[model samples]
Target: MEFSSSLTLLNSKTPFLLEKRILLLEAILEHGSISKAAKAVPMSYKSAWDAINSINNLCDNTVVLRETGGIGGGGASITEYGKNLIQSYTILQKEHTKFLEKLTTLTDFNSGNLKSLQRFTMQISARNQILAKIEAINIDKVNANIVLKTKSNQRLVSSISKNSIENLVLEKNKEVLAIFKSNNVMISTNNVKGFSARNKIKGLINKLTFSEVSCEVNILINDTDVITSVITTEAAKELELKIGQEVYAIIKSSDIMIGN
Candidate 1:
């Protein structure tokens, strides 16, 4: 998705004045040494020093004060101007985030294209916040399937289309965020064991039906609870599902949707 106007500073030509670099400077000031600041960001010592050098070159006055060998040993500290710069940058960053969020909300409200609107929406899922990537869609007269891969290699199957996928310019290895609510995931332990998934409900197999026409198998997760229907009977038997055995019901938090 395209960046909002408020995020222009992050995409500017001046590479040295980036927010991350500014943050690195602030972190170094806070930690009193480049090595400590690098550790704080989980970055290499060389990378931290490079960022500091870049920031120093960008500004007229020196932002950091480095004290050499003494009783206390070498340490770094921020100059008065450095502290002021951090304060100003923090304020601007907050304002920019707010402005972009508002713009995103307004765009969602007015857009008729639901998929397009969803692309711009920021959602939190599974304790991690991410954006949605609508990729590789295939449409048919009966149903449509969209293949969506997330930043973290998580795959999602949704009903969308090939034309829509092309329009979005979805390509292999492209960086795209995937947004889903925590409830949307359908969990099953067909092959996996000892997984730490939270919402597993145990159930029994009530009926097993197989045919050459179309294989359908029904499994009961609970006595009065929801039943899971699998398309293939081979897959059902492979799961070791029997009439009196126990199976789990796996549902992600994002899958549960409430609407009129």
Candidate 2:
């Protein structure tokens, strides 16, 4: 088997520079025109310009300089910073390639479990991430309502756009991670009816944490799973919330996100 890797620089969650953008920058340096560079990179002229603008906005210093009255109306040039960026990226890419090659050799040849590396590398701020299997999918013209079954036999539902269903390639019995934030979960002392939220799982309050403005309630739904909710301290006081008391966790289907 062969291993290859693409190097990218990110500004928080957004990508600042990638292999394709690097190629576009190189083409711009060679051709001296955005239009010619776009053609060389096989990207649209507008996309090339947008990439340049994005790079400039993310960096403290301007990277690409535009020149007027050059043969074809106007042209583009790379700054010293941009040239140094390319060289730095090239060096990093070589090291990245070497690291992946070593990783490939260490991987199990027959199993081909390289994709499993994501489980260790993936990190998010979401407090709840439940492993579930896709029990069913109800699709309409505009959206899809997915039903997921957890290991503890609890069924959770998520509502997503139809385009997302296609993009994620969701199907029955496929494993996925049901993700939601602690703040999005609502706690109820009683089985309240006529609520807009669709999901409700009854459990005992396992723990309670108090802060100046908010309270954290941890509910033990099963032997292995615990769901947490962050609610206002005023609400917690009004409800007289206590550990070991029975309560229900409520969540809206739209608030749940499905990740594979």
Candidate 3:
């Protein structure tokens, strides 16, 4: 069998860049019009526009610029930042090809050892994974405080070791995955002022499940995102949490883990 691979760049767990999307951007750069670019890529104009918007939303910098009221109505142009991305992706694709080639040579197809390599893939057990962008980073002698903003415009603070910042290459405007256990999330009915925890996001309870002692609370923070919290059944009953009820999800800064 022939071996081939496709390269993709991700922001947190979301796919930020793909081969077809890159082709769309390249076509836009060449044609200087979104409509023309869409035709060149064999994609619908709406698809092209949606792809651009998705990239812009995930990226720290705007990659495409739309111009209007020109000789030919309006046209779209790729920014310098977008051009740089194209170049970087090209380099990464070459490296990815080389890596696949080396791996193919080292593998024995009949040996069935590929199953062992599957175990090397990383899996996180954390129930809560929120996509966020690093807004700011403050460092002390021991720890670094990272300010993150979610797509819903909710701000979260994460305190991690200074060494972790260097290891993860964390910086301002970088997209990261904020992970924490569901048990670490505390649900409160009232918006407690001056709480010790750094994060207190107000959301509506959309789902609730209760067992003998534990209860699972799923709070809808935004139209597309939800936060899950595990609390004692007694506490949940005392708080009288129900579907459609608004509440706050509290979490400690130290409990939050940032992952790329």
Candidate 4:
């Protein structure tokens, strides 16, 4: 969907060059004078002279001939070598344009099929991790609800809260990593050491949801997984969670929940 310079050469010895210089050279040859060529190419005379000087430095032969105060009054003309260079460059330019046109046609021809193939490959690979862009953060006195918009235009709603959200400085368009662990996440204090899990995700206590028999605690990790669980409010407070503190959430693949 985007176009960029794709001039790849088979050999490695070619000097670094710009296509615009060749275009300027062609215009100079066509117009027969530096001032006229500058106008024809819509460039300054200094820029045109600079390009000519660069080319002259690269090649063995002088590309342009200048006459001072002639019958036609001090004009410029391309040398024989310069004419040859322009002709070759024009041919290459035409071929390059054709190549790009062909490439575009091929891309359009297979774009739909390529997308379907990519989707099929992704399905076969069973990829679960997705990147989400945080869109809105609503922090209440006791709770916070975070709304995220994913790259694929999917919406995810996460409830956290005032103190914890403020601690992370969660804002609109911030990239927060959303991880889905199993229904239960292992929460341990910094002092509580020893974990076999590969991803020992860390966070701070964000919100507490209490029911008649059970309660849910939300742990906010840095731009990543927000582990939630049913834990006693007293236990949540006993964790000494204010606005910011350190906590760890242990998650195993078996504990990960995946969805389409």
Candidate 5:
């Protein structure tokens, strides 16, 4: 048997996902039944169904054919769409394995090198990464204040250490990514008095998703940029957030982050 490795499809700029779904589809094609496919992959039937549903949502065209009651009873079949996806995945897997083989052959390969490469390719937990241009900067002995402008004319300020300023070569007009955790954003329908946060970006509520413990809200600013926020569901109800309601997304300069 030949050596093999695995890979998933994703990139830093346009994050996309596909892997087990491809495998499930391939198994369905071989077995001609969803249950059989699930068994082949050692996954629960519910999980298989969920994966199939997710794949269906991602495609405009149906990738699988299901029959409720036919001459031979209900069964599943891989459609042309699914076959094409399987073919593409098979090709990518082969190339990805070959890349891993080559990496193994490198003389200086070590655990640290592998870890560094993994971090380089892995996506961070931060959901929002807005491209902004540095408009101004203020420096003190320890910390630096960075003012950034988005394409829609909205401005944000981020505070970082003086060392970060010199390390990233940050200056006026230099393009940088302003990243902040979704949980760090505070939502308010009305401005509170004597707030300390430096940035209060006003935008319309575009979407709101609430779960038991947390609520995820998307605010549309400058008509194009969407700022995401995750807060306690209790807080969301207190604010009485609704779509089209204008709200302010408050962030501290220290909570904002910078990336090249």
Candidate 6:
């Protein structure tokens, strides 16, 4: 059987490798210099340098080093740490292949359903995703109230229709993730009062990025978790938002999506 899948070595928040970068690293080891390695991997010298810089930034230790003025001037080689990472990735690749082989041997495997599932498994365009667990779910005749406790112990409230409660099988103590677009989150520098939105998470402004019309504001909660909101550029300037300023992320419960 022939199938294709990708293996990624990720740090807690960032990807550690793409296969091409790993191939370039492997070429560095075999060819003994960045210039030669670039030619071996058929990559431009500038692209190879950029990959090296990215690799160094991702790791705690310097993974690749440039040597100079020792009979041979200015060449590059992988560090011991980098070599270890390569070996680890090679082992992971073999394990991935074996796992795929085992899957093909299963008798009741449904490829059609798996393919359909893969479509939804793709990364959504939403900018904010918060991992949470259901603390409580309140139900009335028409509406359902859902309470979510995030990993950082921050609380969020969501309201959905009774039909959604039944269809999604809402329950207490269930692990789920909340997804919402940046524009769905409203930002306020002052205390929000008499608002229709159910979720109001207070956080410190970590960063603010501007576009032509809008700006993306990143807020850090409890020094751990982060949520982002998109607000108009004019609003941002009016609020006089700066790094470390306190702000609130307001989200309507109906706007939040619950993913199992």
Query: Best-fitting candidate, measured by TM-score?
Result: 2
RMSD (Å) of each candidate, 1 decimal: 18.1, 7.2, 21.6, 14.2, 17.1, 16.8
Candidates ranked, most accurate by lDDT first: 3, 2, 6, 5, 4, 1
TM-score of 4: 0.43
TM-score of model 6 (CA atoms): 0.53
TM-score of 5: 0.54
Clashes of each: 17, 0, 0, 6, 0, 0
Error of 1 at 187 (Å): 51
| Candidate 6 per-residue C-alpha lDDT over 122-159 given as tens digits, one digit per residue, 9 for 90 to 100 | 58898877778899998888988789999878888877
Which candidate number has the best lDDT? 3
Pairwise TM-score winner, candidates 1 and 3: 3
Per-residue lDDT over 1-260 for candidate 2, one digit per residue giving the tens place of the 0 to 100 score: 66776887777878878898889899999999988998999898779888988888888888899775554436999999999988999999989999989977887753525544555566988888877889999999898999999877889999999988889999999888889999999999999899999889888998999999999999988766788899999999999999899999999999999987
Identify the runs in model 5 with alpha carbons over 4 angstroms from their true place: 1-122
Sort order, TM-score high to low: 2, 3, 5, 6, 4, 1
Candidate 4: give its CA RMSD in angstroms: 14.2
Q: Relative to the true structure, how large is the alpha-carbon lDDT of every model?
A: 0.55, 0.88, 0.88, 0.61, 0.83, 0.84
In model 3, the worst 10-residue window by lDDT is 111-120
**Residue 184, candidate 5: C-alpha displacement in angstroms:** 0.2
Q: After superposition, how far is residue 114 of candidate 5 from its true place, in Å?
A: 26
Off by over 4 Å in 1: 1-12, 68-73, 109-260
- Please write out the lDDT profile of model 4 over residues 1-260, one tens digit for every residue: 53345343332576534566666777777877777777777788778777778778877899888665543334678889988977776677678878877766768633444444444444322223445668887766787667776554545566654665767777888765454533345566773557554345556777666666555667665655455655555665566554455777555533332222
Give the TM-score (vs. native) of candidate 2.
0.57
Q: Write the per-residue lDDT of candidate 3 for residues 1-260, one digit (tens) a residue.
A: 34688998777888878999999999989999988888899798879888989888877899989876444435989989999998999999999999889888887854545643553464889888887889999999889999999988899999999999989999899877788999999988889998899999999999999999999999999766689999999999999989999999999999999987
Which runs of model 2 end up more than 4 angstroms from their true locations? Answer: 1-117
Model 6 scores worst on lDDT over the 10 consecutive residues at 107-116
